[model samples]
Target: MNIQLLANVIGHEKGKKILINAFQNNKLSHSYILSGPKGIGKYLLAVEFSKTLLNNKSRQASPDLMVIQSTTENKKHSSININEIQELESFLRFTSANNSYRIGIVDGVEYMNYSAANALLKILEEPGNKTIIF
Candidate 1:
């Protein structure tokens, strides 16, 4: 499928290029890690990609296509918590609505705690067609 992720002026030029390349490739990685300096739209790229992927399927029927912010209150999702990771795992485990993709985005992964990072690693070890990270 030809997907459009318009990330211009978002500061993730390299990510935009990489995503374009991934879309062009037949073997799109099931998991990705987009890391760079802050305010570079790394998380924005992930959200855009998820939305693009959702366009191919029905967006109305699925609630699990959630954007997870791994943060505590105070408007800070700069840390990935263990509970949040567990929720992500649960979302991944469930059968998809209409049997299609359901994306989970964990923003600000650099602040992940040890427990959450370990949990994420487990998911990474077990491959799934529906998951992507940024």
Candidate 2:
């Protein structure tokens, strides 16, 4: 697979190369943490990487892709909570269609509260086969 098609983001050549190498080499881990300052296209990279893993470009239409992000309710920013983590866990429990990878992308992970973080940690520790979380 061509790296350019996998992740379309400009810049972050190093990051894109790393992800493409992992995919080509079949050396993907169960979990990955993409940390950097905000507005650095981390989420975009993750989504594109997921598209490559799942062989699908339309993330919204893919059952194998799960994305968790902070929510805004009543003009207030709500941190990612344990319930969302639990939902992600449930989503990952199912078998991936076409036996492909079940990819989970958690954007704005820094907004997760303590309980939510712990829940996510549990998922990371015991991610099932063919499950990849970013």
Candidate 3:
């Protein structure tokens, strides 16, 4: 995929440049927080950036990327939990085929339960070489 083209579509060239430069220099922070109003492309940027970072052209087919979001079941909204967080940690342990980036994107993290928030905190405290965006 042409990342430059994608970046133009998003119209966040400055932000994208900073991220790309940091990524190229191996100086990216362990975590990132992107907060804004709905429909402002925060999620889109995360997904696209993740795909680029992981060197995967197709967003759906990227094994190096995991997106965590809220779900609804039995008419009740579900939030992130310990199991999910544990799975994320486990996913990080696996090495990429060519040592690509391992990325996790937590969407709507405000919906996480108390335990899940704590778990996420613990993960953030020790991010290893993986990249997580909240």
Candidate 4:
């Protein structure tokens, strides 16, 4: 969890800033919707965030860290569908793995279908201390 690592991965001052803030504050949103055009570090930041969660080396990474990309694998340009949101509903419905916080990084949130968006809204409506960002 060095600044160099973040710089290399995120390649931006803002990412470093956000990481520093969250890490220092000891608080990070459970859910973060990384939205942006393709190849502009949204995915990079998401990946970095996942790394942080993996080692619990930063405030962002916790035992409940989970990343939901737009597609599973071998697929490109597919938006996040309704089933993904429903799956999140189920994931959120459960308790944390280690009684720690749960984080869901829903990339490309804008691409979610109407049903998915609504489902996400419902989940957001009752965050219950779960952090959500878009």
Give per-residue lDDT, candidate 3, residue 41.
Answer: 80
Cα lDDT tens digits for candidate 3, 1-134: 34663563466566677777877787888888877775678777888887767667653668777778766332244477778888888877687656877788887776777888888888888886765654
Supply the TM-score for candidate 1.
0.75
Best by TM-score: 2
Give me the displacement of residue 101 in model 3, in angstroms. Answer: 1.1
User: What residue runs in model 1 are displaced by over 4 Å at the alpha carbon?
Assistant: 1-11, 56-64, 72-79
Best by lDDT: 2
Candidate order, lDDT descending? 2, 3, 1, 4
Return the clash pairs for model 1, or none.
Answer: 71-77
Give all candidates' CA lDDT scores.
0.67, 0.82, 0.73, 0.62
For candidate 2, give the lDDT of residue 115. 91
CA RMSD of each candidate after superposition: 3.6, 2.5, 3.0, 4.6
Q: How many backbone clashes does candidate 1 have?
A: 1
53-115 in candidate 2: lDDT tens per residue?
A: 777755366889999977643324447888999999999989998799898888877778789
lDDT of 3: 0.73
- Candidates sorted by TM-score, descending order? 2, 3, 1, 4
Candidate 1 lDDT tens digits, 13-77: 77667777776675567677877676677776776666666663333534647566645544434
Q: What's model 2's lDDT at 52? A: 70
- How do the predictions measure up, each by TM-score? 0.75, 0.89, 0.82, 0.68
What does candidate 4's lDDT look like per residue over 71-119, in tens digits?
A: 5433443478778877766776667666555556777665666787888
For candidate 4, list the clashing residue pairs, or say none.
53-61
Model 4 regions lying over 4 Å from their true place:
1-7, 30-33, 54-63, 71-78, 128-134
